[model samples]
Target: MLFDTHVHLNARQFFEDRDAVIQRAFDAGVSYMVVVGFDRETIPLAIEIAEQNETIYAAVGWHPVDAVDMTAEDLDWVEELAAHPKVVAIGEMGLDYHWDKSPKAIQKEVFRKQIRLAKKVNMPITIHNREATSDIIEILQQEDAKEVGGIMHCYNDAVDYVQACLDMNFYISLGGPVTFKNATMPKEVAASVPLDRLLVETDAPFLAPHPNRGKRNEPAYVKLVAEKIAELREMAFEEISEITTENAFTLFGIKRS
Candidate 1:
């Protein structure tokens, strides 16, 4: 079985076939998935999905792309939402300098607020970094984020900082990028990362892996992410599945029955 530690089922991209997409994921062996709530509208929608399905779970926080719009009241609302039994984490939040959707200062501020909120709520955080690795690491360090730990969602290639993230007690999650033949860095990082500290995600409705590249991604494709990691590490497919699924379970505090 597989556990996709990150995905966005609440996104409008799946409005018409969301249920079918979820069914495909379970059929594809994705036993669990974290449906992230990265905005006001999706936050409630995410929790709604989680509440309706045992395999689905929610992570609440504002995305850095919308950081400028985040406010103290919003943080308070997220903090409150974190109390839900189905809400497992506090973000898919971090910096995204790849785009200028929000200024760096606001992104950093929002990231920090959510980090503190995660600490306050005793839930792990899920990070999103895009061309903002340096600032993300710095802010994480400054916030002493190791205390709560989290997943570095959709890690592309940060081999040099793998140890740094590990030191902060983060599990490195690989996504579609790892499956791209041209993506040498992510392959290297996937091969080199310790299996115990590795996880797999789909980041659904985005970043679909090779073979399915350029198409809308789905949770079912997490198997491809795990398979790529296995190929990169030269390990058996089943072994990578077991190891990463366990890693996800541990990081997200999901208990096996």
Candidate 2:
């Protein structure tokens, strides 16, 4: 079995065939998944999806790219949802310098607020970093985020930053990029991250793996990610699947069912 630790079944792209996509994931041996919701529209849908499926869960947070739009009420709403039984973490939140829709300072402020919220609730966080690895690491350290460990979702940075994340109690999650022929950094990180602190995800409707690279990604494709990691580490595919599933369970505080 495999745990697709990060996914976005709530995204609009899946609206037409969400159920089928989910069925495919299970058919492909995906035992568990966490649907991440970063804004008002997606947050409720994420929890809704989780509520309908026993093994699916949700993560709620604000996206850094749209940092300018997050209001106090938004944070309050996210906090309220944090109490939901199926909601497991506090983010898909972090810095995203790739887009300039939101100023970097505002992004940092929103990121910090979400981290603080996670700590207040004693829940782990799932970060969304883009071209802001150093700032993300520095902020995590400054906030003492190790108190409630989190995930560096779809981490695509250099191995040099892995220790910084590990030191701050963050697991490194590799997505479709690891299977890309030219994605050297993710491959390096995949082979080097401590097995116990590694995870797999698809970030579906996005970054699909090699053979399916240009297509709409889905949770079912996380197996390809595990296969790539297993090949990179010279380990069996089943072993990678098992280890990553266990790692996801540990991080999200989910017990085997």
Candidate 3:
């Protein structure tokens, strides 16, 4: 069984055939998934989806891209949702410098708040990093995010930064980018990150794996990401799947039965 550690099944892209897409993921041997919800609309939907699906879980937070829009009430709401039985983590929150929708200062402040929230709730957080890797790392360190170890979701950064994330008790998650032809960094990260500290995701409805590169991504395609990682690490596909699934369970505090 495979665990897709990050997926946006809550996104509108799956609105029409969400259930069907979930079934396909199961059929593809993806036994577990975490639907990350970054804003108001997707947050509630994430919890709702998790409530309906036994093997699926949810993460709630404000997206860095929309940092300016997240109010104190929104933060309060996310904290309340964190108490939900199906809610396993506190973020998809971090810096996204690629977009100017929210200024860097606001994004950092928002990211810091979410990290503090995660630490308070004693739950892990998932990071959404773009070109703002350095700032994200600095804030994570400043916030002492290591107290509540989390995931660097779909980590596409260089190998040099991998050690810092690991030092902060963060797991490096490889996604569809690792399988892309011209993507060298993710490939390097895939090969170098420790197996136990490794995870895989699709970030679905986005970043579909190679061969399906330009199409809509889904949890079903996580197997392709796993397959590529296995190839990169020179390990058996089943081994990589099992280890990563176990790693995810450990990180998310999921007591697998």
Give per-residue CA lDDT, model 1, range 81-132, as digits (tens). 9989989999989999988979999899899988998998899999999998
**Per the 3 Å backbone cut-off, how many clashing residue pairs does candidate 1 have?**
0
Taken over the whole model, the C-alpha lDDT of each candidate is: 0.91, 0.96, 0.94
lDDT of 3 at 67: 97
Model 3, C-alpha of 175: deviation from truth (Å): 0.4
lDDT of 3 by residue, 110-229 (tens): 999999999999999999999988988999999999999899999998899999999999999999999999999999999989999999999999999999999999999999999999
Please tell me which predicted candidate would have the highest lDDT against the true structure.
Answer: 2
Worst 10 residues of 1 by lDDT: 248-257
Q: Write the per-residue lDDT of candidate 2 for residues 41-130, one digit (tens) a residue.
A: 999999999999999999999999989999999999999999999999999899999999999999999999999999999999999999
- Show model 1 residue runs off by greater than 4 Å: none
Better of 1 and 2 by lDDT: 2
Candidate 1 vs. true structure, TM-score: 0.98
- The whole-model C-alpha lDDT of candidate 2 against the native structure comes to 0.96
lDDT of 1 at 23: 96
TM-score pick, better of 1 and 2: 2
